[model samples]
Target chain A: MTNDNNDLATLALRDVAELVEEKLIKLLPKAVDLEQQVIDAMEYALLAGGKRVRPFLVMESSRICGVGESSALRVAAAVECAHTYSLIHDDLPCMDDDDMRRGQPSVHKKFDEATAVLAGDALLTLAFEILADEQTHANPRVRCELITALAKALGANGMVGGQMFDLLAENQDLDKIRITRLQRMKTGALIVFSGESGAILGMAEERRCQALRGYAHDVGLAFQIVDDLLDEEGDSDDLGKTAGKDSKAGKATFVSLAGVDAARTKAFMLTDQAIQHLDIFGDNAENLRNLAKFIINRAN
Target chain B: MTNDNNDLATLALRDVAELVEEKLIKLLPKAVDLEQQVIDAMEYALLAGGKRVRPFLVMESSRICGVGESSALRVAAAVECAHTYSLIHDDLPCMDDDDMRRGQPSVHKKFDEATAVLAGDALLTLAFEILADEQTHANPRVRCELITALAKALGANGMVGGQMFDLLAENQDLDKIRITRLQRMKTGALIVFSGESGAILGMAEERRCQALRGYAHDVGLAFQIVDDLLDEEGDSDDLGKTAGKDSKAGKATFVSLAGVDAARTKAFMLTDQAIQHLDIFGDNAENLRNLAKFIINRAN
Candidate 1:
């Protein structure tokens, strides 16, 4: 892995994560009764933690667009909820069949499969609920845009469709273009949404939003390639997940189809393209440029 | 079952169902690729069709409030999407473990569990997406309100929590009050939302909204009690579902706690209370009044 002197901290990611962490707990409903079981499962899956990439992207991107920390934090938390819900459902026995997520026992393993399913459902519902609130944004139009955007990113035609393609891809060999399209729908959609959210909240000009979206798109694909490489090359302990499952499942991923050397080169090249998209922001986009570099270089 | 000469036709339910049916198919994205399996599962689950009670409630309530038929139709379709999503998840092997719904094999039975899960998830996402659309309501505020209402009715503190309570209730003997609370959370919350949605779309006065809410509450409870009665007494063929599963599972229900006679009487009393809440609207509420009566008396 290529280590960089500059990391996400320079971008206020720590502050964003801390604020999002605090708000996530407050955002969760109290387990006052019998239903606490599912709530417990939800908190376990949500708070067990990931690197908080989506939240960081939402907050930092929103910050660059001059959106308030408070509003960005709310949107960030909602993004995490949406991300966590996807992880929970994806790790189900019928899906990825993973037993660990973010280094913790998967929701179905920690709780029951039924609890896991309901917890994911509740989390997904909560994400929309949070975005629909006044605290997320003062303008109803802005809130509606956020809601629709989030829905589009994760709906049947987006992430869900991508997952379906992935399941099918395991049986049939897929070419690079098909795999790229699958990865875009599967993971890139949400990443694009994460990057675009701040602009939507800040009501940034169309061109700026498009610029951020382009940057996000390039980095998002690069990020997935790195993930594919890690799945093939990294250990589970470092990845904090069951690594190499892609190869073991006969899955058609970039790393599986393209040689590791070519895959790594593609990731780096894509990261460069991503950084180029942020050139319009000049010095102000320094953090985003470095963030792209960091994505391709991260070990876990 | 209590037979009534007047049925849902008096409320224009058939027209609402027809329009909502068309809109539902339109609202669902076309499956153009490998992901068609999940989309097919979604369509099967959604279009297999329940009685379309939620859509009817939304359309009729909106009609009484002078909201346009087109706007009501969109909201109605959204409500049905949410309803169908819940039903899909509820019938999963991990949850109710039912095999039949709307006289068709459950999603999990028809397709694979993964497809069923994704289909349910996509339907839930589609519901929020539909509600967030400008076509659903011209005002962004109204759209936001609808989104929040649907989320509140379905999230961890709402229907999800209620389902958790229900799963726990099966292990221990519960009283009628507890059963009522569980039912309120599980099914009643969505039903209440169906009734209140028209007013939310109309931006009706607080008192009028409260009236619809109250009417919805009573009718929702009455509707559940009748469901319990049907679970116990109705044939599986008539119900178009696997009846006696609740009793088979030894799940404590309103009918289990209170004798059939008491449960039946309570349903009628609640129906009367539901009808009384419509007094303010007088002639305008006749359809709602008949709707409430029809809810308690429906054989299915």
Candidate 2:
């Protein structure tokens, strides 16, 4: 946001924010009278916008799967709430110990550690609430399916497990396999769901869902590889947070294990594979293809 | 658990735990490889094992609604997972700052804060996952209703809002009405869901659901009043966690505002009202009626 890098990705996110933000604001309860501090913190963290890439994936994926735009937007906001919750918690004093996020003070820094924790918890809870609500879908079965996928993506074997793995990696010597697994679990599972959501909503065939998931998996890894690249090479102003945090924390990343050149090549290859996975959708997937390229080329 | 008071409530909990814990353990993925620490912490907190009151509420409510015991157990485990997650978070240094729970080290005390945080998160996610799974119910509609209720109960306006109120109370003088509202939001919402879950599962009449919810509301209040009383008069050895924490932290509670004798009378009145609400169920509500009476009589 501070810098105008990754024009297409930025544009895609702007489009998503336009489609998703108003509804997200409505979904979040406004603090009226007493005990409003944590509510304030929840709103603050959510409003601190990143590129909204995950929401974009939900939108584009749904577009390909023929889900209604309004329904897709609901899922988009839900996933973003989940993503934002993870970021808030990850920025805590005990986790990554970051003081800033998305070019602003982290939730814990803005409020206290306790408020940040509760806000994150509330946001995560809101995600499921949105999906479970009748507004998300006409059929309760479809809604239940979505809730299950999102819950699994966020649970122990998914993001939380990946976080645990990442933390332990700081003290242990992690190889490429373990690091890649960590990256996939930490970030890939949710991306897979984001892309797969539209398919699920539309009740698309298993073949199509798998195709979207495949694209998401490759793109997710490419996105993380590029993140490692940016964290290694970019500035604090450009990244909106500290650079070289992976190295500083002694955490093993794709770029850390493999040098910058190899990591860049891997990212590019993954991007290509990701685009190939979108071929089944033909012309409709042009935006998705562009998204993959934009992901690797993003400077910050 | 150690006090052996409230025989009916304790016996009901023991029955529910026996029905629920095995399924809960199976649903939780065991860590056979890397990133086992957080998983360990999650199990530790869950296995620390209180009297399992919430799960019992779900089981008994479902039984009266004619739901199968096996099916009811799933919902019971799901609610207990949620309850355990809340306790783990509430014990963090930034929250209640308790080092022990149920005569054992708190999750954050046994494991590091970061692990405790992730474990709590994973458990919460797992609750939704359990609810949404096909194994929980044959009809997704029932599952979705359960999930929506649970999510609402756990979200900002429910448990989280109540927690925020309690935290703010440390700095402000809260009146009886405000404290009652706070208690409802923080603890009452989940208990209502726990009682209402069975009706939703069994497709009971709205009247029945409301009656169960009415009973739950009074019982939840009585339960809290007894908790405050225990905090004021019971020792740490009996309560398993620190006693006198409410006064020590300078937080306002029912007992603090109403005094010991008045609070005791109010709890008994609430317990009586709770039992009366279950009159429609007749002999089938025996355990439920017993649970209401036990709430005010529990020593710890």
Candidate 3:
């Protein structure tokens, strides 16, 4: 058996993922006769292999903030759908030009570019559709807030905005502040959204919600820094596609600004800062604290 | 001055459009300078000049339903934003491939394709964001319902789905039934959403909402049919773009399916049906009724 210490966190994460996954499968409407093709594409993208890190954050924050599992599951699925849409668009030829994802051909590579685009667009719209279902319609005010938060996280000021900045930053020697801001918007915003959404939906105290946002912001930056580090040192086989591709693509990353060692140190500092934000919750935030450590030290 | 009969409808529409335009122009937060860029693209598409028909429908419907003009303006802007996003995306290189819009270069033709795509995506997200602003936070349930309605109108089951069908039907013979379904989803959904959303937001009677939906549906189909006839007969200079491009692209169209005379007749019939739906509301729906008549006889 695995060591109980790490296993406990792993077990909790797995349980959350399993529960969210089951809820999603149940919530998704199966195609009856003619719309099977569209349904199939949706299922393929959604069910494809990936660690359920975002959903875990959603559920963990909700639980810690005293929200029930059912309500949090809707928020979890909504974020996952948004993330999946980003992945679909990012893999397009005009975008990242990626042909592989998660050890399989990307959506466009497996199907076609048009289909992939539509699938991504459909998933993005469906996220809000699912959240507005009759089951969650009871909390109408909170539901609208969640929709607004998710849209802001996904829109120009959030992920798409960050992407535009990243695109403009290509091949340029960028400063540390600009690079951090870019990553914070592109990668960190959604992560913050994932955790903060849970807090908002759970009706957590305003101060606690603010604390969660702070925690997520620091963790997200540190997480991306670690990802940059891994891309420098990890093997393509382990990464499922590439390593050092960022540098080759003239992309700006933390390692490009500072040496690998310095980037690593900065990453650790961010992680420590992230953990410090959890001090208010004390031992109740053990999973979040441990998750940050795991993210920083992740191998594959 | 314009004829008194025409003056009231024209002046009221112009008043509503100007009000919504001013509000939207001021809504983007100045804290993020990048937001200005987003607001610029959105305004470029929205304010460029197209009659502001969709916004007029929203505002007029809201007034008929006893909804306040302030709340109506927000939904009007939201509907226009959604419509503008569709136009931007439809003009992209991978989609309709048009080069001109409202007598100017298309969003993609003017800006880069990637920028246009992001702009369209941003505008779509902004619609929800604007609705959820603290200003309108008073009616969260109404906001949530409108957001869900707009999402559905734009998703695969609606405009995007209809576009997919059109793309696949190119150079292929599609039956009149299939063509009707395509136009209904692609064009009808949003118009229906525009008319129905006002009533939904105003808490109008369910029967009145249904009547508005029915009226909007017929009018939407009539608008498409009229557009088809114009494409076949309109001058490029007068229409602000090259006419007959639909036939050049070998795309399926109502004129191609039923011929020009039949198409015109059908448009008139649809308009009549739409006006009939408004009879239940009588003079209160005069603006909507006049709007339907105007749609069938539009010059561009």
Candidate 4:
């Protein structure tokens, strides 16, 4: 992509991030009483700030598929909620045990551990509620499709399964194949769902759905590769998280297997392949193509 | 209800319980591997015997509303999954912190705390996946409705919210109204969903739905009252849990507010009212009326 195209993509990303933030603020429970600390904690974690990459993918994919914007925005918010819930749980003392998230105290650190657990649970339940509501989609079929896709992506065979595998991978000899499978389940599943949500919402052709799936598959891996690289080289202040923790913990990562320079080259290759899968959509998919590049290039 | 009617309900409950257990066994992930300890923990926690009250409510409600047995069974299993997930999380060290459940060590005790947390998360995700699948109901409308109802019942304003209140109520003097609200959100919410699920599945008339809701409201409170009674007087051998723990912890409960005799009388009164609400269905609701009586009369 050219510099102008990059600028356009950057502007579009910012707009979508703002839109998602606005929708989420409206959707989240908001009362400032101490009695409802769980809701307060949930809102705190959700509104705390990220790149909104998943929501961007959902909205952009929906735009390319000609789906309605309002419905797509709701789905985007739901996806972000689920994503945030995962981050909260993953940072619990019993899990990855991180005290900081996005350069701020994690949910458990900000509130109590019990409140953190309940907040994560509430956010997850709210995501399903949002998708199941009739306002999200006029067609009940579409709603069920979204719920089913999300449940699968987040279930034992997907995100949870990946997390379990990751815990077990500690001090274990994980080869490239094992590590790839782990990343696919842990991180790739939701990314795939984000990409395919538009196809499901629009009831797109099988070929179009297949194209999105291919694009998501490569982009998801590339995203993980970039993440591994970032963890290795990025500063904690810039990344907004603890840096080099994976290496410190002796965990197997893409960068560990391929080295940082090789992993960077591999991420670029995957990004290029991901963009190629969007050629069928032409100019309608320009944002998605740019997103593929952005994933590999993002600083945080 | 007569002794014969009570016997008939007992037999039906046993049949439904067995069916639900069988379905859950098949539905749960199975593979005995070291790395799959999380799945094992979930299955272990789920299969531990209880009265299967929620599943029975679902099956009975569906039967009266003219829904299919197969789809209702799926919903019943899903309800149990959600219920079991709650129990697992409630028993976690950060929550209720109970070491024993159903006469066995809790999930966190049997496995590690991390495994228990992940298992609970997986089961919760699986419940939505089961409901959203086409096999649960041919109509996507029905699927969406089920998903929506379950999510509402389990979210912040429902189970999680109630839990937060319960935690806050510790060492505090909670009056009748506040305690009632807490129990309604905590336990009553899901029971209401179980009863109304049949109406949703059968697409019953608004009046019938309202009737079921009323029945659920009274029965749910009565059930909790009996629980408080059991906690005060029942034996650990029979209850499969520590008895008298509520008073020991100084947590306010129905019995704590009303005394044993008054609490027991209130339970009977609520059960009578619960039966009255089901009068619209006449003979079709015999099992439900009997179940209401059985809930108060149960030893455990």
Candidate 5:
């Protein structure tokens, strides 16, 4: 993928995210009068420096499925909400215990711990609320399908379960397969859900959805592998979050279990597999193909 | 308000809650085993005995509007999920910090804080998942409406907003109106949402829904007023949660500012107003009328 490809993916994501943000701003009730708090927390996390990878996947996958822009925007917003909630909770004292997120004070640190917890809970609930809104999409079955996909991705079988396994693996003699499963649940599940849910709305065949799910799974793993490698070699300023915390915590990471070179090689291989799977969609998925490459090569 | 009416309402609530519990047990996913922690927390808190007021409002209000049992059951479950999430979060160390919930250890105390937080997040997301499921309802619009209603009730204008105010009011002076506003937002919003959401499914008329909202608001405030009085007079075992701690914490309650008799009188007035609005439903809202009475006079 060329720089132009990454730029196009970034532009498309920014445009869709802007639309979703506008819709969210309007959909929230004015009566609460806590608009400032809601906006502050939302913009703080969303507009901060991290790449909008999940939302980008949602938009690109939907586009690949030939979905309408409006429908794609809803799914993008919903996925972002889920992603944001996880970040907030993961930063809590009992979890990752990070004080910074995306180059800013973590929600729990900026606000109070209780506020951060509530904000995450509120955002989590709001994601479903946004997706389920009648005006967001026309299909009830599709909406339901998206909800199921998201729930599974975020619930025990997805992020939280992965977090549990990661916690358990700390300082333990964890094997390659077990480590991969943990990473898959933690990050891969939501990424896969983001891709497949968009396809569900587009009336895509089950096989195509499955193939997209496979692509997402591989890319998601590759993304984490690269992240692990980056933590070892990337600049702290570039990463936004504190790098190398994984090794300090004795958490088994791709770069820890295998060498940095091995992780980098694995990332490339996974990206190739993802791109190959998108061959059936042909050039229609050029943007998604490029996005996969960008994930592997991203500096941050 | 009579003995016969109260007894009938009690029996109905117990019966419906039991049925809803049974339905939930089956609908839960077996593959996602991490759900057990959340499911146990929900069951422990849910079965610990409140009036099942919110779920009953969902069921009875839906019946009043002539919606079918299935839709009502789903909505009831969604309401319960939201309610459960609030309780779990409210019990956290940084929040109310209560050790006891429903006469037992709070989820945070029963499990760890991290598990409690995840359980709450799971339950919160699960509500929307339930609404969005195709098997839950035939109408897409209805599912969307349910999601939006529950979200609004749980978000800033409702539970979170109220909680924010509560956090601010701690060790601070608050006028009666401010206290009422806080209580209304925290507890009343969801109550109003429950009845209005049920009405939305049955009758699409905005005016009727508004009337139901009005009814819910008054009843919700009335419900809190009684709770204040009960904390001063009710038994711990009977109430099922820690009471009398609000005064100790210097928190504002209706009784703190208005006195017990005044608060009691206010509750009666609110309940009357709630009943007056139900005249729109005429004889069709007999259950609602009884429910309004039940909200004010209950010991727990």
Candidate 6:
């Protein structure tokens, strides 16, 4: 039964990933006469292989909320574009300065630093354009809600703010609460937005939205904890990134503050809690439930 | 009579600027505990004084098209935020590397480079949020139109692409056509959006929109040409920025490609052409006509 569930989750994730990728490919602007390089850079950064977890969250949440596939896919693509833009900027020389992303050269490394910056800016702009387009949803109110949620999540008080904290927190002693806050802002906010987007799209009741929010909160933390755990133990090749970066930088992570065993136990507990929040959706949220487990248990 | 027109233009510009500034102050996110610095950097960059020409264009265009002041002011603030974000990013070390803007240290210089990047990101994100808000317009379609216009203006094919071209065109032999195209993308796109936004808000006829487009097109180029002229001849103190950097970098500008006298002549011609497009609106477009002349004649 457990094996069957794992297979089902993997298949579902793969299916959504393919659909989202197709939509993203169609949505990205084609290379024009003089602006080819920037477009190429954008495509390169976005097309680099990842698990597409954020888009999956958007699609699965939308499906459970009874939104149409076209609207869901557009939002999913926008979420992915925003996520890719963040990664591109985060890898810049003044930021993390990582040369590799998803086992390939980072956008800044592949193109020039200036190109990387412009490409990132373009991608960020494109995300809002996608959300604002009429095809995203029949209801303009729904579109506006998606835009507001995304802006709030990605703004200074959320993802960018979290990044600022991460930069300052380097070499500083931080407790679990501070770390959690940092992670929540840096990684969890977008996840919450992705999940909540479905509720907005389907015009779900407030209780339904709150339950998804709760689920997103726990799942996002668990995902971050697992990231920390993987950084501590996973090989660079398997991770497709420079592993152990946190320990090398002396950054305070969950695994660094708590022992590996404690951190793993905590992630498992959070996964369980995240699943509990889906009780309101019952059988309709099976994929989400499996996703919570998959997030903590993934090898990379 | 000319002096009287100038005075009226100056007073009108000031009024719009003040309105936009007040709205911007209220619209920017308040500093939270840890993310206070990023918010500070965003405020610092945005509040740095300029002539506020883009917002003025938004306001004046909206007024001419019969849009309400409140909705127009919100969009005006949004335009300023987006423009400010571009300026902040343009000043980064990997980009233009300017240390000063509006007679003060640039955002990256005042803060750190990472903060500058994140603050710029936040501000850009905030621009969309403001446009997406219900306060921007009663009609969701209008809000979406504003967002789409801003996004396209600031996207890869627009401002970012123009910047990319500018970076690549440095020290390269380029003709007036290429230079104009680059300038249109770099600077003219946003100006066009600012003007066109009013028509979108008012739901004006296509012919009215086209008139604003023509005005924006000519005004935008004239604005860039005058910018080049100032960079060539104006004092750094008066300009509130380092002047002559384009010539110093061996950049091909209208002043460089065409001599100063010819470039000045072209600016005058463009301003006249821009005014000619406004004839359709008659007395309602008087402010816009004056604004066109001001674009060419401003000392700073």
lDDT on C-alpha atoms for all candidate structures? 0.87, 0.88, 0.78, 0.88, 0.78, 0.90
Which predicted model would earn the best DockQ? 1
Q: Which docking band does candidate 4 fall into?
A: medium
lDDT of 2 by residue, A57-121 (tens): 99999988999998999999999999999999999998999999999999999999989889999
- Indicate whether candidate 2 or candidate 3 has the larger lDDT: 2
Task: Tell me which residue pairs clash in candidate 3.
Answer: none
- Interface quality of candidate 4 as DockQ: 0.62
Model 2 C-alpha lDDT per residue in residues B1-300, reported as the tens digit of each score: 223436766777787787677877877876644668988887888777777888889999999999998889889989988999999999999988889999998998888999989998999999999999888889998898899899889988889888887887785877878888899989999999999998999999999999999999999999999999999999888799899988888988888888998988989889889989998999999888878767766733
* Cα deviation of A278, candidate 2, in Å: 1.0
Q: Please write out the lDDT profile of model 6 over residues A108-191, one tens digit for every residue.
A: 999989899889899999999999999999888889989999999999888999999899898998998899889989999999
TM-score of the second chain, each candidate in turn, equals: 0.95, 0.96, 0.93, 0.96, 0.93, 0.97
How do all the candidates rank in terms of lDDT, highest first?
Answer: 6, 4, 2, 1, 3, 5
Q: Cα deviation in Å at residue A76, candidate 2?
A: 0.1
RMSD values, in order shown: 1.8, 2.5, 2.8, 2.0, 3.0, 1.8
**iRMS value of model 4?**
2.0
Superposed by TM-score, candidate 5 places the C-alpha of residue B108 at a distance from the truth, in angstroms, of: 1.0
Q: Is the docking of candidate 2 incorrect, acceptable, medium or high quality?
A: medium
| All candidates: interface RMSD | 0.9, 1.2, 3.0, 2.0, 2.9, 1.1
TM-score of each: 0.97, 0.97, 0.93, 0.96, 0.90, 0.96
Off by over 4 Å in 6: A1-4
**Clashing residue pairs found in predicted model 4:** none
Better of 1 and 6 by lDDT: 6
Highest lDDT: which candidate? 6
Off by over 4 Å in 5: A1-39, A172-174, A233-235, A258-261, B31-43, B171-173, B203-212, B280-284
For candidate 4 chain A, which ten residues in a row score worst on lDDT? A28-37
